[model samples]
Target: MVSSSSAPGSALPGSSSPIAGPAPLSLCAREPRVPADRLVAEMVPPPRFDSVRFGTYLPDPNQPSQSEAVGVLEGFAAGLDGAPASGARRGFLGFGRSKAPKAPAGPRGVYLDGGYGVGKTHLLASLWHATPADPSRKAFGTFVELTNLVGALGFQQTVQTLSGHRLLCIDEFELDDPGDTVLVSTLLRRLVEAGVALAATSNTLPGKLGEGRFASADFLREIQGLSAHFRAVRIDGEDYRHRGLPEAPAPYSDEQVTRVAETAEGASLDSFPDLLDHLARVHPSRYGALTDGLTAVCLTGVRAVPDQSTALRLVVLADRLYDREIPVLASGLPFDRLFGEEMLRGGYRKKYFRAISRLTALARDAGRLVDA
Candidate 1:
């Protein structure tokens, strides 16, 4: 995190003018290359949540489910020791033989079902931290990162790598594509059979993961098989980011955004459309690296995303910026205007809503820079 020095708009010691520092870097110009080993090594929670624990989560007293979820997850983490392995005989691709016996009867994992900004990621990361096993025996990542790992390594290697982990916590669990659904379903089945525990958090319930996004009927077997591995835990609460706070500040003028981008230390300035096009070239797994060392992000000529693919990529970028708590200063349309009515109502609505929530919060943080 970047520390504040001499308030927001003040000049540096040697700089003669307020906006005279070196020009901020352009995020559109960056193309990060992440090796497979680094992907496996960086599977833990992001920096924003590295220190969160069960005690750090303050459940709204009005919502009993919030407190209940904390207790249930704490118990789940404590029970990981000496968990029994499945009795089914392992076979090729990690599936059981036709004659293999049934596995033990119990909920193999817990799922946190909730909406955006209700601390779902916070609780999911907390479980990863609270688990009794060593760091190497547990893994935490978003649904996108998990699938990217499978793509980087072959399916068999991905299963082999995670099967040894005692616990795997997936944040923002998604079922957007049919292929991803089948791939993750088969992989999880393999992990469960090998005695690995699973946990996840998402806006939709396990049973209804792809309801609005895809033809769920076509993939019912894969979807149902995915749901059976976990017991869904519902968390009810409004978005904590703006529950009682004032609305996020309006978008800044392009000139003002340019000034801040040039003046702020370790900031980046990018035109919204160019950045979107650049994102298409970079892998989603590299988005986190794309924002590394950025103290602030400034975008000019912001407008609505043109399509679902671009909107999803922007969502991933918003998540990385929020994970680092980096402030955002932008020109043109506000964050709430970034997605259209149709896109907001589609199957990936939750993901879009989450991006708006996080980006607005960061925009509010940037207001301090403008007022200085």
Candidate 2:
């Protein structure tokens, strides 16, 4: 947590005190509130991908599936027709009546199933760009952000808000909890029924979601119902972040990180453990807001997370920071060592691997600051 004496724009406890220039901010002290309207408005792609389009995506020349996914998704987007999905409507007699033109014969959406850093997000966002609807008629966000929106505005309100969209692109679809599985499953079903198209990218195939994370058998119907809505596209490739690229640089020294934090404009400094404690205090839905204005993140005494809960929270924070393209400078254990062997071997290992990949990329970006 933030020290009691640390005022806004003041030096955080872990940073060197009495340093010159602007004081480093502390993420531990921030508690941001995102209104329902802002949440709805910000559902578009994050800044890192704000301008990504189909032409901007570079599929691996060696991976045919990657290229194939592009063509398939493009065709899927063209089929959207920029209108609500054709479904049953109420008749004058107060009975359900099917629309004259039948809905398309096959799946109502496309699902990109692949490993981390394979450009799944790129393709998902490109599809969003390619869809023939106005920005207000389409939405793009991670599965967690979508669920968070639902949490903020009740379920019915969420459905009403999204039901009119021509396309909804969900990135990083998760199936870690049974409740989320049911919630999102029901939500997607309602949206699909409402004539709204869908698309998603995930590390796991739709059919295999929630398999190892929970007692999936208990919710097999919901899982299968979710899977049935999309045509699963399998994308196979090594992590693009590290492929043909040099490994991430070593951690910076504490003094180096603190110096950069104190001198760099818009930098926030915090001890890694204290930041984790602060994350616990704030809801995960607001993690994006917590990182609102940070240009860089500096951490000291970085070490392995103590448990699965803390590790999971760290994953969400890592994702939010990555989405905002914030550089992370840290001392102590490297990001690859932040999770234990047991955690890496567990059901949520994919999330952990993606977090490591993203953090490593950010760490590499932060190296330039030290070099300067």
Candidate 3:
């Protein structure tokens, strides 16, 4: 999620710089101990949603889509001011003694669920951006980032920190891990009980969470129960990823691929598998360690990434590389063919789509460098 001020160069690591040398430590050499506040801040920067107003969302004529979802979100946002006192209870007399009153219940939140690349993140970001500013009153981030924060900060402390926010807007809300499911369930329950309004976007509906992951019945039940407290809205349409896009070109020529390979070999590039292993072992903050003193990544034998977790990690890697403008060279499959049939329908489909898109752009950039 780090932002770069300029695009990275296409030169090899040690080609231009006299003092360029191997990194002192590898990404897996040590664990990253990022502070909780810093992690949250880095992960939840204000989204680029200035142009994403509700009026701009065009819905599909054939299906119930973004328009319906937008209406529900607007209503929910409007009702926030009239929300009842949370946890309020009427005073009661017991043994000729009167008990103090508690706060009343508040308005429920909204959950926007849809397929991959349906602008779920866009709408969520728009909602957060349109809300009037109040310091420490709103929180917006992807579900993965929040869960990672919870792991780093501990459950209770993370809950306390987030509960203070008046609204919580989460994107890509899907449960693949049992521990994360439990932690998120508990955290959401606490937030709702404390009267924090919520707005979230997800590819999977709450009831269908962890469908193929062999999730426990109790965990599924918890998700379903928590879902009951939110207004569920389904945004239906074709994936926006494929809309108005030109046809993809053929795979890179042998010479084009060889050019990148030679550059990497000259710079002694790291393998993608090694990077993936390191990513599995450390926090995402540690991923920066992979790019240290490195100019290019050459990945081969990438015929098909079958596992959903691996595909998701690849998505993150692609994002980091794209943000840094790093050139990547890969072989063994075309960009569009890297994903298997099953993976296209898996929970990580959106991530896979993103990875393919970014990788294609990077490949094109690399091809341009070779052509030049």
Candidate rank order under lDDT = 2, 1, 3
Candidate order, TM-score descending: 2, 1, 3
Task: Report the C-alpha lDDT of model 3 over 1-372, residue by residue, as the tens digit.
Answer: 222211233333225533333221223333445566776665442323446766676676676656788887765665554343333221111111223233223335667766655666667766775554453567877677778778788888887777666578876565555576677878887776665777876544333534222122333354665665566677766655456755544455544555555544222233445656657766564454345444555554446765767767777667666545666666567778878888767655556766787677666666554555
Clashing pairs in 2: 85-195
- Best candidate per TM-score, number? 2
Better of 1 and 2 by TM-score: 2
* CA deviation > 4 Å runs, candidate 2: 1-21, 84-105, 205-222
What do the candidate models score in CA lDDT, each in turn? 0.78, 0.78, 0.58
Candidate 2 deviation (Cα RMSD): 4.8
Across 215-302, the per-residue lDDT of candidate 2 in tens digits comes to: 2232334456656556778776778898888876778889999999877887888899999998999888888888887889999989
Model 2 lowest lDDT segment of ten = 88-97
Stretches of model 3 off by over 4 angstroms after superposition: 1-33, 43-51, 55-58, 61-64, 81-107, 205-222, 249-271, 285-302, 306-309, 318-332, 341-372
Superposed Cα deviation of residue 18, candidate 2 (Å): 9.4
For candidate 2, the per-residue lDDT at 27 reads 86
Task: Let me know the TM-score candidate 1 reaches against the reference structure.
Answer: 0.84
